[model samples]
Target: MAEEPAAPTGARSPSTRGTRRRGSARHRSYLRPEQPSGSPATSRAARRSARAGRRRRYAMEALAAFAGLLALVAFVGWWSEPARQEPPQPGGLPAVVGRPSLPGPVPTALAVPGLRPRERPPSPSPSAGPPSPAPVAVPTTLTVSQADIPDTVHLTETGRRDWMHWGLGGAGGTVRKRDGTGELRDLGGRGDRSGWDGNQELFRWRDGAPVKSVEATAEGVYVCGTGNGFQLAVAADGQPRTATVYLGVWMARGRLDLRSSDGGPSRTVRLEERHTSRSAQVTIRFQAPEGTRLLLSWTVEETFTPHCGNVGLQAVALR
Candidate 1:
């Protein structure tokens, strides 16, 4: 018998294929996420599972991207921040967390060291401008006066640059200050002198040269007649100094002249006793630059008697 050919499985007969399929057949299976349209039918659960898996994968990818973005942001902030280091401390003190280091101090201007010594001050030339004014006040000043001899002349033993006691030996003999600065000087005299041990007033000293201590002494040197005297000087050291001259006149007139070497004021004092012996003191105060001097002259101005009328110098205390 010529029977009709059997239709293949999953395929409809020619007459049934012409129109749309009925019932469950009309509902085709949902597409897989990776499959194209019109593919063979697959299980619904399998397609649904594939779609859910795709969704979960996409979510995971998004979450990973967000995590990467957060990491990048943290890196940028860390790079922009400043680096800090705290000094190490002993005894296990806690370190400061976020304190930044401070900058060093800045210099105001650049300068060369040790340039002042060779620099010379500007001054006007003699012809360029009127002469500069003389110093308003001299660096040194001096004053001299005569007075009656005091009964007790207190000798300054300490606190002196130098001290001297002259005529302690004899004529052409002298004594200087011990451990002194060598400032008191005898610059020689104008005439001959003789030793005399008959002076009225006596000198007492606790500090001496060779003779460290002496209660009282009345030995001296004398120069007779006018135009003859003792010339002395004291070196200046920028400090006030005093030279006390204990002198006597036997029937003679004495003149004391004192001046500063630096053009300071000069003073002269005179004392006279025509017939009897008279004693006096000449105190001189002066100041000058170091290495300069205070010039002093003690002379006999006139004589009452021609035999031995003279100026007698007992002792000189320089303190």
Candidate 2:
């Protein structure tokens, strides 16, 4: 062979291979820990380091989760809050203000017809249930006697549906002057009744404070008191005339007596009771004096029950 191919340079003898392996092992030994299988202390230290690393990783993950939760909470809070409005002008207080606003344009003029004269409606027929009898305003005249005077009188200035008439006080009832000229003075100072003897209260009449011999005429009588009540006697000195009387009171259980005392024998012409809560009118035709003296006396002895002020006598007019 061409001088046997130069000895192969890459090939190693068995001895050389053994020596190189030994040197590699020696270098590895130098770099390794003192304990071939690792000392107990070193092994324990490595395990602790591994555990610390895992714990640190877990801690970082937890921190990240907490941060994420905080961010989510912040987002939800921001979304749930009401939308912010523009800041108010300085010194301007927030207040609720409402005003009427036209939906569109307003009209400048209105089309209305001029008012015309009106005509009255026709009256109902008689066959139609007594024809709602035309609202005939029949002015009434009332004649009052001394015996017909009420014991109490109360009135109101207001009106009510439950009452027949309302005027000034509680009942709003009043007694107008018969002559249409005169004022309501006192009860003439007629006090309470003295006793059960009716006559004792009959002739008893007082004015303001003194008992005068004169007699005053009134358009109506109003009363308020207790006991034997009050009395009045109006009789003419000569001719026979009809005495028309009207009595009204809020309370009930009152009595009235109209009698003739002149030209004719003294006789009971008309008698009535239950004059309260009603308006009473009586007409008695009898003989009377022309310039006769009429007596009106009142008294209060006891009360069955305390009562509020009420309408006594409303009015009295000579027919």
Candidate 3:
């Protein structure tokens, strides 16, 4: 080829020859790529796999975030609900009222659940009303005997303590049965300092453990109900044209007291054993103005033995 154009010196150099060969190989590799059969498909598949992997990762991250948010929302909702409360039961009764319904008959004690022992209510003032009729003279002076009257004694509001709801513990009692025997010995008050109570509305005594102490307070009367049968009788210095009455009947063991507005000695009401039975009856008699206000009470004393009693009012009628 015309002597190869005199074999250019620069091209004939070893380093230049090597460079040209390398360039040629590089050019051939770029142009034909040795006719690689599966290379393009493999590269395309790899790119697709990487893209799919990235998409899968994004989806998984999104799902994880969604699950976390859902759990957080559920927890928040559960924490925001209100708690439930229970209501009081039906048929429950209050602890205090004006007075019992009947006489001699054991009065009903106010019954309520969940009441605190120290929850004392203030006493109410006397009620204002018209003056009652005066006591009239009878044709003849008949000796009145202790008899079982079907009515119960009703205590006046003023008779109660300055802050006593029912006695001390929002309750009181009367003599159930007064057998001159030991049956009436156990005396206890549900309210009072003793704080003794029971399921029965009436105060009950264990066979040998009836209350042994009898005490009286401005709140009401407390008796052991078993001493030599209490002596319920008319006061010694009784006045004509006047009558006395007792209040409250249903209670544990205790006594009824007669207090004068003039601050005289109190006469203890007594229980009489009925001729028909061993049990006894409670009675109190005194002289008071037709509409005169009276104070009654049942207090717990600091004796070793316990005593219980009731508070109530008596009926006053002209002969």
The candidate that wins on TM-score is 1
Which portions of model 1 show Cα errors greater than 4 Å? 1-138, 152-159
Alpha-carbon runs more than 4 Å astray in model 3: 1-253, 263-266, 270-281, 285-287, 298-319
Give me candidate 1's TM-score against the actual structure.
0.54
Q: Give, for candidate 1, the lowest lDDT window spanning 10 residues.
A: 111-120
Worst 10 residues of 2 by lDDT: 157-166
- Order of models, best TM-score first: 1, 2, 3
Model 1: how far residue 78 lies from native, Å = 33
lDDT of each: 0.74, 0.39, 0.36
Between prediction 1 and prediction 3, the one with superior lDDT is 1
Query: Model 3: per-residue lDDT, tens digit, 1-319?
Result: 3555566555577887899999999998899746375688888988999999999999999999999899778655655544333344467844333332223365333323443222234555689898999767322121222444332322222112110112333234332211222111123333432223321122212211123222322232323333311222222223432232322333333344545444544544443222211122333334543333233333222222233233232222221
Q: Is candidate 2 or candidate 3 better by lDDT?
A: 2
Error of 1 at 35 (Å): 32
TM-score to native of every candidate shown: 0.54, 0.27, 0.20
Q: State in Å the error of residue 227, model 3.
A: 16
For residues 216-297, could you state the per-residue lDDT of candidate 2 as single tens digits?
2222334455434445554343443443444444343444443333233333322222323444444444444444433333
